[model samples]
Target: MTVFLCDGECEYSYDDLLRHLNQDNYFPLLKTHHLFSYFGNLVKALTNDVPLVLLDSDLSPAELDGVDESLVNQSIPLSVKRLPSMGEVIEALVHSTSEITMFTSGTTGQPKKVVHSIQTLTRSVRRGEKYNNQIWAYAYNPTHMAGLQVFFQAFENLNTLINVFNRTRSEIFNLIKKHSITHISATPTFYRLLLPYERAYSSVIRLTLGGEKSDGHLYNVIRQIFPSAQINNVYASTEAGSLFAAKGENFQIPASIHDMFQVVDDELLIHRSLLGQSDSFRFDGDYYHSGDLIEWINREEGVFKFKSRKNELINVGGYKVNPGEVENVLNAIKGIRQSLVFGKANSVLGNILCAEVQLEEGVRLSELEIRRILKDSLQDFKIPRRIRFVESFSLTRTGKLKRL
Candidate 1:
């Protein structure tokens, strides 16, 4: 279609969307931010046959510049239009299998275009029916993987997807209370941010954390706020796709549920998956090896406690430090709401742990206080060598804490 408005506004009718689908028009109007991804898929779709398109509101100026030029050169038949809500967007693309697309955050590296049919996109809709047809205060951008899942969830059940696209911490809190939000899926850092506004948005039914790791400490904090909510920590990749998710932190997938798991040398391997594009979901072994580290506390437990990500470990000094260990301590501090631990070069330690955190509003803490708090739970070597307070940390499209 020509224009698919995606500023979380404008609700078009079915007939109007149909006209766009058959001819060249627009349904769910997207913002300029989504134009880059839309252009990328549009370019690919022109080459082959791609039905669905999702445009995440991310990408650098260089990437965007490439898209703008490519569009002009290809002379792609597309334009932009304004739409009101998610309902109208679904109505237009509901009937067309080729018109549905899902956007991924590209954590492994470069973002690749993955297109899915309406049948594939809607496969997990009813599967997520626990949150079906209910009022959902969408906390994520409607452009990433989480956003696409929520979009399809609303489309399948016709739920009132309250478009809380760019709500601030204060604004999101107010909206949840005002709109009576029931289900939620955000990064662990986002949940930590809600602690300040906990009293306002405590009446949650379901809470899911993805794009980042979660420990017992963070899980307990969320449990305190959303007592009745079924909190979940999910593990899904772009190549592997999302099928079933764990109900809470440390929850493992049952073999009966998903036989795609295999552990070797303490590393998890998931080859057979049916989530992402068909090209990504193929025949040979059909596995996506998750480069995650794991250890078993006890064989009798029949499950493994999740550990550091293999690719994300920081090689500080001669010894290596896992960021998750430091992040756990940071989350437990009194004034610190959320923190990310990463390594930066140091002449002495080779590499030292550095922390960027957000302090609780109206609360002040010196670097010494921050270090002392970390010292209470973490080892001396693990404490941040340099501490910096930030208003907010970077986030991926799927609500993961970004290590910028």
Candidate 2:
């Protein structure tokens, strides 16, 4: 296997990787080779009931102090290792049930711990010769659900994985070019940030966008960069592994799982069977409320589109406005690289729509021009009353927009 890092390349054969796994040492905390160590730990966990905790590699000392004590104690750090006499424990763990714990990105709020088993995590990933021999880029952190999916997909199919974690845009570009990466799965924010580099993407054969709404503007931008690649917008969550995939601008519910999902009072409800844990959300015997609002695109054809999170709805003078809708329109506008729309307090209006926009590098755009463009596409109430141009938006460790 070939692993590309910001500094240089590291190659390890299958046997070499196994030998490294068998060595008596703790895995590196934030190194690029953490990918290999993760698999190594996974192998050991499979044979024992030891749960794995993945901390954010970018966490500060203060942040690390805030982590749970049990998790911190159980966590596998860079210098620790299992004892050699634990063969019996490893055998028991391999045959016993164990869980993998991951923390949310906290893009919406405080990051929380989520638990999942190997079966639920890999249920939706496809494996076969069709996926083999392909080269994939490790854009997401291996700890996040999206990152785990990318790793498992490549591992199960015997494909090559090039580590690009913690790398700058220029470094990622060079790595992609060097390895001729064919598949990439990342959030829309990551893609938007990388667009300004304008690196050659002819080598990319497939693009998967998830963790955020995939609007038409992003689809168009990706198409321009990699014309021949297959672009797919995937709808998934840490709770729900992988639910649906859409090729076009809209996220259409697949017909095969039509009965597994439903829209009730504008909230999307997915069957409980698809979720890793169903206790946090409102779950009846069979379905779990997804907390996301959905709009019917074609009632007759069972087509629908994601509107926004039910909790994220902006109240504009008692008129509800979905920020995602406004952001979608803003993202489609020329020169706007990224945007965040939200509700701001107003004495007279109760609440008013506001937007913060980040333009492409070297591109100058004014608030009035953006407002004028919004006037043509969005309703007066839905348009942001206040628009501000910004240099860049804050992102969480998982590459999601950090909503304030």
Candidate 3:
């Protein structure tokens, strides 16, 4: 029988999943680093149609505002009739009425809860014989939206998942070869970290990037690493599941839901029907400001390109500069592995742009040289005033570069 998951030294089969589901009880608010246990609990709750709250393993009680600390990781007895097989359990989970509670990153303030049903969570998952027996490099924090997306996509198809999240560079490559990982769906930053491209991993057949805006330079590098792979990007969020799919940088909205979106002053507003229910979500009429700034490629056909987040724009001397635009320029430069651009408070400019750059191994780039190159491509105000060369960059839980 095909292994269900390969997490470190631990290997779990579909039989193990069945045994776990047949247990007398399951945790409703689980917080464990053990991926199998977490998944087992998740499956139990969904199959039994019991409400569940997903919490990051490292999350503290202070981080989660309203959750009772005493109840976390505590199990509730299950009296429902046990399923005879794993297939039956999966079927029950697919048609589950479970309301799953997940939290935002709380980048701006306290983490807010968003609730979603199994249908909304698995809307983008495509299951078929063509998708079966594929080995996936699980590269996401299992508590987050992207992680859940990948989990359902693989699990529903009974595909094998090899956990690679937070693994070292050498370890990740070793596991890829050992397991013949065929598909990888992660943030661009995760791919960027495997820089100074070594040998090609021909085993990878499909690569999906999401959680951050990626540039052409990253795509080019990914193509070289996974020559046989078909590269794509997914547009998903905590408030909503996957909505649009992109090849390079352009996202084409499905025509069936074309009337559900409205672009006002470059900010994309989404209809309430396309979103998960959340008390934290503030809607303007039937539309909610998505805070995503998009440029129309063909507004009539619902084709568009994501520019940047509205709140991510930095104001410098009465001018608004998108950090992603500058980072794209830096990333395109030869010998630069990755770049992070952000704003710093300044006495005169209110906010002065700054960048942290990670160069390819043995690469020597002066700060002045980078500034000179930027002058030709960017306006005076748009260019970062300060640039710092770094060996590594700080990453968020989702593997995206953390912006200060």
Candidate 4:
């Protein structure tokens, strides 16, 4: 829409809406296209729906053709279209965080939308960009909270926002080599995937990992790949955002938290991060009865290491899904008796949801039917990519679904 030529010393394009954003005139960051997917969704949630049609340069019609194809409902058109340049994306996000919408992981239940003020969103960017420089390779997205932070941080810095969508590890490395990318933040799974091609380039300056564990599985390869680069681990969630983080190769555990945490049953309780708690989350006193099940890597150090998730939330291609969301839809089928949702370990995404469904005696149904129902109702991102039928499910002593 409004493009800032971004050639005169500032290597970024800003929208006319930015005239209202700031006086400092610089935010250095780069974000991938998935963030725009979130933006497309965000605008819809504000209006109480998702756009039937999506415009994105990163996705092909084949990728989105199966989205919503009902004829009568075709009237309920949702389009996914691709736009060129970062300036256009910014124009679409003209309103600040206060005007933005946030949806939870819905791990315990249905995802809830929290209307964050543009100020809240701004606070997140301000706090995130506070200690760190605004420059980046622009790898994050805006669909999730973390990605949004990356987008705004770069906008505030007036740094180059490089785009290389659908590129493989080698292609990305080549871009990094050509652009001299300095900072990059992605999931541990992303880093592990990058390891195979790490030899292609050695210019990485800083590496940040989250969205999954970063122990030896990830850190080991990182050490071997970028011996000179720094590595950091972060612990946070969609609702709680990021709370505790450790920078550099040798991360010393944190001491007593200065903010949000509880010791219920010897486990910590985390509240949703104050969107304004600066870029890095600061623990505040509000004790949100958190739902996380994790332990520490402590012999005595406060540094925490993630063991596993207690919730049914799965991350697929950076999209969060609640198994129950899909299970509920499947269970509604006339012949379906019950269902179970679990994430199978994935190499690219940290974990992806797979469903096991049971049908009534002498009755059979196709997974495609169940999937169509689920995909139609929930975000396509939330639909399970894999489906399996089970004769029956095993229950635990506590009366919970057991892994097959």
Model 3 error, position 14 (Å): 1.1
lDDT of 4 by residue, 1-404 (tens): 32222222333234432332322221111122333323324433222222222222233234333233232112232332233444444444444222443344333443444444444444434433353433365544334555555555565444444553234567667667766666676654345345432363456667777654345434655666766678776554445455556763233334554444555554466645444232223344655544444555563565554444445457788876656556656655566656677788889788777888777667768878888778667887677778888765554211124543
List, residue by residue over 274-308, the lDDT tens digit for candidate 3.
89999889998999999999999998888888999
Looking at candidate 3, the ten consecutive residues that score lowest on lDDT are 80-89
Model 1 quality (TM-score) = 0.76
- Per-residue lDDT tens digits of candidate 1, residues 223-259? 8777778887766555444545665556456556446
Which residue pairs in candidate 3 collide?
A: none
lDDT of 2 by residue, 378-403 (tens): 88999888898898887767777877
- The CA lDDT at 64 in model 1 is 33
Best by TM-score: 3
CA lDDT of 272 in candidate 1?
52
lDDT of each candidate versus the true structure: 0.60, 0.71, 0.90, 0.49
Worst 10 residues of 2 by lDDT: 24-33
Given candidate 2, what's the lDDT at residue 60?
46
Q: Comparing 2 and 3 by lDDT, which wins?
A: 3
